[model samples]
Target: MEFDEERVALYETILDELSPPDGEAVSSAHFEKELELENAYQAIEDLIRLGELEIVNTNCGHVRVRLQKPVPSSTPSTRLEDFSENTVWLAYIVSGSSPRQRRAQRLFQNFEVGEEHLANISHTDSLAQVPGLEDVWCEEVKGLSTEYAILRKEYVFEQADDPWP
Candidate 1:
């Protein structure tokens, strides 16, 4: 649990440069090129645990990252649950998933990548909310990259022919 300075810098750059000043939801995939598949998930997870970042599932079909603002009037957002549904961004799944799901998964539901969902999950978590339907999401969903997938859907799902392997 030593200080991860690199992770810290990654989060900082993400907030300062990638996310717009308007507080719009930005794609977490912005860090994909900068992070190795092994590190991207952990970087995001650590930032979340340290109360420095939030990964939100946009109901409009993508995963987003929003930085915690420090303005005196801004209420600090330590986790996804703390965010109210702001119409400025696409819809957030923070209000959709249960509390337990928030702890277990990074993103929720099938989301758009370049053209559609699973188009580019490299260096990011896949959409795996419920237990039983993971196989369906894994199998039915096409265009997933094998290199950087972090599957955390834990609902005792039947196995499917994993594209990641």
Candidate 2:
């Protein structure tokens, strides 16, 4: 598709200013000033829609736009499965302790408690009542005892109101 020259130039300018050495997202404001574009947002949208650019977040105030060359798709991976409909999972980690390990311990303990509570509920009622409780599983666990924890739990879904959901 033929793209507007001015918009393409603006996108190029933005990409030049934001291209990361490590290949990361750039901010939106910086590109606006560098390109001297009056309407960066509209210009960005146009370029993206034309398949000439992509937006990346650099964790700063603005977003980065990168020039992207399209490539033809090859054979798709069959092993990839879509579980967006079947699972409900939540993960949380605590922040800020002198020793990072201690915070992790606390996070794990909290997760364990949540897991146990759900397990009890599942046993007492049909998994349907628990919403997303399919084959409940803990994918990862880390924490400092009683202080912090990181816990991940997944449940299967039969309906919108499943226990895990």
Among the numbered candidates, top TM-score falls to 1
Query: Compared with the true structure, what per-residue lDDT tens digits does model 1 show for residues 1-165?
Result: 123566546555554653333455556455665443335545555444333355656444335765434211232332222222321111111211121122223444323431122334232345432221112122112333212122322121124412111
- The C-alpha lDDT values of all candidates are 0.35, 0.38
Clashing residue pairs for model 1: 61-112, 131-155
Model 2, span 1-165: residue lDDT tens: 123566556655554554322234445665567556776766555444333356655455555655432112232432213444443443322232311222212112344465454444222121121112222232212334222222333334354432210
Candidate 1 at 49: error in angstroms?
2.0
Q: Model 2 misses residue 146 by how many Å? A: 55
Query: TM-scores for all candidates?
Result: 0.34, 0.30
- Report the Cα lDDT for residue 1, model 2: 16
